[model samples]
Structure formats: C-alpha cells, structure tokens
Target: MAAASGDNPSKLFAMPAIVADRRDDGSILIRSTTPLKASARCVGDWLEHWARQAPDRIFLGERASIETPWSTVSYRDARGIVRRAASWILAKGLSTERPLVILSDNGIDHALLALAAQHVGVPSAAISPAYSLMSKDFDKLKSMIALLDPGAIYVASTKPFAAALAAIAPLHRATIVSGNPDDADALSFRTIAATPESSEVATAFAAVTPETIAKFLFTSGSTGTPKAVINTQLMLTSSQQAKAQTWTFLEQAGEELIILDWLPWSHTFGANHNFNLVLRNGGTLYVDGGKPAPGLFATSLANLRSVVPTVYFNVPRGFDMLIAALRTDDELRRKFFEGTKFAFYAGAALPQNLWDALEELSLQTVGRRLPMVSAWGSTETSPLATDCHFLAKRSGNIGVPIPGTELKLVPSGDKLEVRVRGPNVTPGYWKAPDLTAAAFDDEGFYKIGDAVTFADPDRPELGLFFDGRVAEDFKLNSGTWVSVGTLRVAGIAALAPLAQDIVITGHGRDEVRFLVFPNLAACRALAGLADNADAREAIGHAAVRSAIGQGLARLKAQGGHSSGHATRALLLAEPASVDGGEITDKGYINQRAVLTRRAAAVAVLEDDGASEPIGCAG
Candidate 1:
C-alpha cells in the first residue's frame, strides 16, 4: 500500500487485531478482539450529551434553496426545540402502537421532529419521499401506512404530497402535520416546535430504555413489499459505539467533525450510520438537499464547493458522479481533499475504475491518495456489522467484524453465507411475527442472506470481501454458479463509462448475459452527438454500438468461465423504475425485480437471432 503524503498513518486509522476462529464443520467466526465500551442508553442520550458539551456548536445546517444561505441550529437550541416538540408529540397520543411517520426529505425540521419523537419514546418512520412523490399509484406508501398505523404523519410541504396523502386518507385516521404553516388542513410544524415544554416531556424521556424502538426504517423491497426493519436504541447506540472504537481518530484528532451528506434519512446508511455518527461525536451535519441523480448531482457539487467536510460519506453511484465533477474542476477537487480524513462508500460494490479515478484525482490535487473504505451490513443490523479501519488494498474489501458483532460464515455451496449476531442487530421485522421468527437461525443469528470470503485466507486479520447475495447467485444448465454482485461490478468496470448498471440474466440457461442500462452522456460523447440529442438516436449510433461491442469483447478476454463472462449484452433505453421495485431510492438495482419486470428484454438476449444485442467476440 502507498503511504498518504503528509498524513500520519497512526492517526488515520485504527489497526484492530482481528481474531478468526475456524470450526471443524468448515465454518468460521470472525470479530475484532477489541471489546466494545459501554454505550448510551438511547439516542436521546447522545443529544443530551452534545447539548451540554457543545452548547453553542452548530449541530445541523441546511438551505432552503440553492441561492439561499445555510440555516443552522445549535446543539443547545436543538435540545430546547426537541423538548417542546416532544411535549406536543406526547400530547398527541403518539406511542409504540401509533408511531410517528415522516413523508419528507432531510431537513432541519425533519431532523427536529424525528429527534423529538424518539426522545419521547415515540418511534418515527421516515419513509422514502420517492414513494410518495414519484409513484403514480402510491401502492407502497398505502401498504406502509397500513402496517405502521401511525398516530400522525408529517410532511415538509403539502403540495407535493397532496395526492399521496389523499390516496391513504381512507386507510387511517392519523393527524397530518405539515412544515408549511399555510396548509390549512394540517397542524403546523412551527407551532409544534414552539409548544410549551410540559412535565410529561421529561417523564416520557426518562422512561426510554435501550430496547426502545428509535425508528422504523423500511427495506428496499427488492424481492417483495418493503419490510419495516425495527431499529432499537440499543441497536443504534451500540453500532455507533462500535464505530467510535474502530475509528479512534474521530476522538483522537480533536477537530470538530464536519460532513456534507445527501443520503436520505430513510435508509440505514444515512440514518443510523452517518446521521447518528455525527450526533454521537458532536459533529456538524449539513443536510444536503441534493441526490446522486442527473439534475440533483449538480446541487451536490455546489454544496461540496462550499463545505469542505472532515469526512465524506456516499454510495458508489454518488462517488461515481462526484469523481466526474472532481476530475475537471480543480477548485472542487482541492477543496474536497483538503481537511478530509477519508472517503467512504456503501450501498453497492464500487467498480474498480471508479476507485482508480478517485485515487488518481486525490493524488493529483492533494499529493496523496485519500483512504477509500467501506463496511457491509443491512438495515436489520443497524448497518454497521464490519468496519474497514485500515486502508484496504482493493476496492471491495468490507474489512472485519466490528467489536460487539460476530460473523458466522457458514458454507452455502460455492459461497460462505454470513450471519450476524450482536446487540446492534435488529430483533426482527416490525408487526410481522412470521418474518421476525423466520429471519433468525436456531442459534439466534440474523440470517443476512449475503456471502463473503477472506481477503487473505491464511491471514484472517486482513478482513473479508463482499461476495454477491446468496439468493442472487444462479446455476447454469451445466450446473455452474454465477455470482451476480461480483459479475455486475466487474462488468461495469469492464464497460467503463458506458454501462451505468447491468442486470445479469440466464438463471437456468447455458450462459450468462447482461441487460445493461447505458450511460446516456457517455454514449452521446462516444457517438459524437449533440448534448441534447435524442436518447434513442444517441444509443443506436453505429459508433456507440461498436464501442459497446469492443467493451464486451475486452471483458470476455479476461476469462474465467462461462458463468463469469457475459456472452451477450443488450443496451436498455428506459431507466430502472422505483415503483416497479427495479431500483431503490438509494440507487441500488434489484436484479430479480429487473429480470421479472422486463421478461421481454430477457427473452431478446436469450434469442440467438436478436440483432439488438452486442455479441462478445471469441
């Protein structure tokens, strides 16, 4: 590994001694030898600690628009506001049975309302805004509302959610609360924030325990309807505690941590991992209103120019977008690397090309490459099962199990299926007793359904790499297995700048194939088309098809087997649909959903006579 210029290696990472225990049955258990320290009782404890320790420090910052200045709230002020809001929530009869549900993006108001609800033992469910705003039918939102049976529903504005609210109006009698004071049909957020702090607020807060449900975060629903993953105070607090232990620099560095993040609070990566980490460490969180989409990424770049974060957190897609901006914009690159400890990615396995680009840019601008690291876990684990405390030699290393967690690697055919058990792990899915019971093994470990392998089999301390999902792997007619997650990442890297995301096909067929979602910008550039050229015109150009054919051929040359290399690929014009369960709000592609939804497209690839596919050369 190359040393980071002008950076002390000792201060940059915590090199914990990982211990792996090999079982006689070909299974393995791994964990960091470092013990987890005592954690806070609940999420409110962290807020209280920060409120007292850094009373005047800016806890949260956000903007109303691109042109507007940031509006910040101090820790002390946040506590006061939370207390008053908690009193109002308590008076509203919101409890475990009738939790608080939020239907808005990340903002100061949204944060305050969630904190208030959690502070008073009222679990808050932050549903993805896309479910309400993007979906025409609102079927997912209605189902979530029915499951939650919330006492109240909150939205930042009423206009965008008017249709969704009306869609679920017949399902529940929950009170509606809007951030916009002008919404006459709902109670105002501003009024609730200013509600008188009653004695009941303190009583309710004192009653909160470690096992108390802090929030309900829904899964991406890749296979079926999204399940409500119960996040307890213990799960949240212990996860952060394990993190602080792994990344000792957060406290050792003595600098106030600052982050500019756009990941939605609805997802565990953003909520329990990033958001809670900031609060636990008394850091300032700039709630970016941007996303990693086409028009929205420009806003993220704008925010990055203004705020040089101490640490940056994003998914592979977000980093991919940011890398493009950073390569050309010298000013943005310099600012982004300056005062930055490292860059973290999750949500999907990052393509090696993207990782190489980021390192190259960091070296060019900062004279040293920043540590690009990742962790592996799901919403049910409070999202922090493993931590890459040391710099990984490759792109996909998810490191070792964090201090309180135990990873049981049981052999499942060609892969090791990883199961997790710890205080950080969720008990089960909310309101579904069957799912709760079926989620665990006989020994009480949460069956995460993901597979992993040792980075260095002989040297257990080197950590592990994320293998594809167990359910995603399929057998060909020759009885060979194809790892979808591994192949997808490799394919994206091999196709570089052309394939944005690829879905593997041929579950029981003789060979693997790809349903690629082409990157329109790159295709247009390759085809020598105008920036505003029609999507079909650009993608169908001879030059674009030739380039794709060459990429596919190149991928085939780096041979493994028929299951490893995709024999043919078809470029998709229509993007993955959020309502169809083809994609998640965080930009992760659901392979099964995509294949099931686009059966005709799959049939096209399976047909030898289909001329649309770019065939791989022998």
Candidate 2:
C-alpha cells in the first residue's frame, strides 16, 4: 500500500479512527468514530456570532478592476445590511412558497442579498448566469423560474440579463430588483438594503429551525432538467461542522482563513462549501470575477497577485490553467505559494500530471511542497460527504466518511456503489415528489450514482478512491467493463498539454477509442504558430497530430487490456456545448451527454476507413 504524505505533523487535521462494518449481503458501512462538533442551527447564526465576536474583521471583498482596490465589508457592516434587507424581504412576504432568485455572477452585492434573504427565514436561489447569458434559447432558465415561482428576482445589472428577463417575463409574476440604478422597471438593491430593521426581522429569525430550507441549489442537469436540490439549515451547518472537525487547522492555525474564489454560487461546491466555510470560520472571501476559461484567466492571475490566500480552492481545470501561468510567471509562483496552507480541488478528478507539476512548483518556490487534498460529495449532500484530512499517497483519494455521515458501499456488478446518509444530506428535491421518492434507497440513504473502491482493502482508514460514475461506465462487446472516470484521467495525462478532455467511445464496440478536445493553446505552441492562428488550423497542424500520436503510443505501452487504452483518437475542433448539457457550470464534462450530442464524432472513430483519426501505432 502507498503511504500518506510526510507533512502530517505540520498540519493539525483531525485524526479520527475509522470504523467499517461488512454486512452479510456483500455491502460495507463506513463512518468516523469521532462525533460531530456542535454547529450553529442556521447560517444566520454564524453572521450574528461573528458580529458579536469580531465585528471589525473583514468578511468579504471585491474589485471592479485590476487597477482598483478591493471594496471590503466587515462582519459588523454585513450584519447591519443583512438585517435591514431582511426587513425588506419580510415586507415583501418572501417565504418557502415565494423565495428570492438571483441571476448574476459572484459579486459583493450578490453575497449580501443572499445573506439577507436567509437571515429572515426566506430561502434564496442563485441561478447560473450561463443559462441566461450563454444560451440561445433560455429554456433552462424559464423552466427553473417556473418551478421556483419566485417572490422576487435580482440581477447585478439589467443590461446583461435583458434577453433572459424578457424570455422569463411571461413565466412568473416575481418582482424584479436590480443592482444597477439605471434599470427603470426594477427596484433598486441599494434602496431595499436601506430598509429600517424592525421587530419582524428578529421574530422571523427566531422562528427559523434546522429543517427550514436555506437555499435551492440546482444540479448540473447532465441527464435532464436541473433539479432544485433543497438545502436546509441543518445541511449547511452540519457540513461545515464536519469540515471544521476534519480540518482542525482552521481553528488551530491562528491565522484568519482567506480565500479568493471564482466558482459559481449556483453550484454547491462554491455556495455551500467554500462560501459557508469562510462565514462559519470568521474568514474573509475575496469575490474572484475570473474563471478558468481562456480570456478570463488573466483576471484570476491578477487577483492571485493581489491577494495571497491562506487556503486556496479550485477545480482541476483551474489548477491546470494556474500551472501554465505559474510555470512562466516567477512572481505569481512566489505570491501563490507564500503562506499557503494546502490546495483543495473538487468538481472532477485532477490529472496526476497536474498534481506533480503543482508540487514541483511549490517546492521550487518554497522549501516544502504544499499538500494537495480533495473531498467527495454532491449537491444533495451539501457537497461534502467524505473529507481527505490526511494527504493521500497520490491524487483521487477522497478520504473516509466525515463525522455525522455514513457511507454504505453496496456491491453493484464489479464496482461498489457508494450511498450516503447524513445530517448534511438534503431532505429531497424541491417540490418534485416523484423524483424525491426515487432518489433515496429503502434504508433512506441518498443514492449518489457514483462508485468507489478502497485505497487499501485491509485498512478502511486509508480512504476511498472515486471509481467512475455508475451511469457513465459501460461494457464492451466482449463484456469487459470500461471505467470512464479512471480512464479519462489517465488519457488526459497520457496526452498532456495536448488533450484538454476526452470522451471514451466503444461502449458496445470491439475496442475503446477517444474523442479528444485538444487544448488549442498548447497545440498552437507545439505547432510554433502565431497567437492568432485559427483553432482549426492549430488543431490540424501536422506537429500537433504527431504529438498526439506519440502520446497515444506511450499510453499503449503501459496498457493492461483493450479497455484501458484507446487505439485511435479524433481531435474535435468545436468545444462542448453548454446548451446541449455537455458541460456543467463547474466545467465537468457529462460523458453521456457529450457522446449523445456528438454522435457523428464518435462514428468517425468507429469507422476503420476514416482518415481524420490518428492511430496509436503512428
């Protein structure tokens, strides 16, 4: 078995004893022996507690541009604004039936309004801006608005969401609130926040219970329409409590927790996990306006240069982009590694090459390498079911079940399907009775549709590695199962700096093949082309194709079976479509949706006579 990282003594993570029980029916139940620490009943309690404890500490910050300084709000100021806005929300009669819906990116105003709604027992829902701004049809936004039947809708600016507003105007009767004062048809966010706090605000806050819904976080809708997963007060608080216990350094480190994040608030990883972690620990969150995309990453790099976070959080794609920047920019590498505790990654499995690159950079900049860790969960579990408290032997180890959570690993075909039951788990989907009924097992554990395997079969405490999604895995013509998650990560590593992401084909065919989305920038560099070269020209360059062929040849040499290596690959010029449900807001590719949407591309690989594909033997 591989050993854990050597930096265990430096970081004070909770070392809990893990208990696993093997059932008679070929299932395993795992839980931590440690009990969950007492957590706040509602998220509002954290805001109130911090206001009393350290009122002047900075809680949130944002910048309009790289040249401008961050506009910050302290804990005391946030509470005051939240209470006043809570009074306005109470006057508007928002409740479980009529919630507040926000359609904007991450900003200071967005965070304040969300806190205000939650302060007085009104649930808030932050919808992804892509559904409104990126999609041509606005079909997903309309469906979500109809399902919510919101009491009020909010936007940071009316100009960007004009088309979406016009599209959803016929769907609901919700009041409109705009952060921009120039919007004539909407109420001003500044005016609503200036409402005088009254006795009604305190009464509503006091009435809040653990069962009260705090937010409605939507799933990625990989298979179908996005389901509004009900996030209750218990789910939010308990997840943070377990996080605090697992990562004991949050309290023991003595330095205030700081994070510069770009993950969308519409998803659970950002809203429930990262955002709430800062709130619960009296930490400060700098709202990062940049993402991992091509044109937008410069903003993120600027933010990193400005603010050195105590704990940095990102998905694998973000890290991949960061690695490129860090390799070229010496100042960024130094600022990013200075005083950083550990790097956390989620939303997808990080390629092992990226992991090693980060470690190498950290060691080169600082004397020691930063511990890269991960966790596992979904939108339904308030996003954290398992915590990697210890540095695992390598990447993809999502540690043992957290406190107040249980992982039931039931035998499913050749894989173990992991089901979760915990206080952090959501009660059910919002207003979807049939979907809710089908989501849980007879034992009440939420079936997450993912599979796992023990890192070490004899020692349960070693943690669990994420097997591929049960729905995404498929069998070949010879009846051999193909693990898409594991193989995809390996393929990306094998085709490093060439393949951005890959979709495994040959579900029922004779051999596995790959539909690769080439990294255009990397291809351009490899081809020695100018920066303005067309994407198709870059991808079709002979040098780019030769590099892919060489990478495939390397992968073939280390293969275990036909299912393990792709014999041929077709590089796709077009990117994954957001409207087609091919990619999530967090950048996770839906394997089934990609395959379904690009059936013709898959066909090209299957056809032996196709000349577009590059063979592994080349």
Output the number of the lDDT-best candidate.
2
Instruction: Extract clashing residue pairs from model 2.
Output: none
Per-residue lDDT tens digits of candidate 2, residues 163-230?
Answer: 99999999888889998988897999999889999999999999999999999999888667899999
How many steric clashes between backbone atoms does each model show?
0, 0
What TM-score does model 1 achieve against the real structure?
Answer: 0.98
Q: Which ten residues in a row have the lowest lDDT in candidate 2?
A: 1-10
Question: What's the lDDT for candidate 2?
Answer: 0.90
Native-to-model Cα distance after best TM-score fit, residue 101 in candidate 2, in Å: 0.5
Q: Which portions of model 2 show Cα errors greater than 4 Å?
A: 1-10, 252-255
**Tens-place lDDT digits, model 1, residues 1-618:** 447534565676678688889999998888778888999999999899989988998999999777889999999999999999999999989998899999999999999999999999999999999899999899899999999999999999899899999999998879999999999989999999999999998899999999999999999886668999999999999999999888887774322689899999999999999999899988999988888887788888888888889889998888888888887898888888876778899999989989899888888888889888899999999999998888887799998999989999999998999999999999899989999999999988999999998988888778899999999999999999898999899899888788889999999999899999988888998988987888888778998888777887777777568877888889998989988989888889999899999999999999999898888855
Error of 2 at 390 (Å): 0.2
TM-score of each: 0.98, 0.98
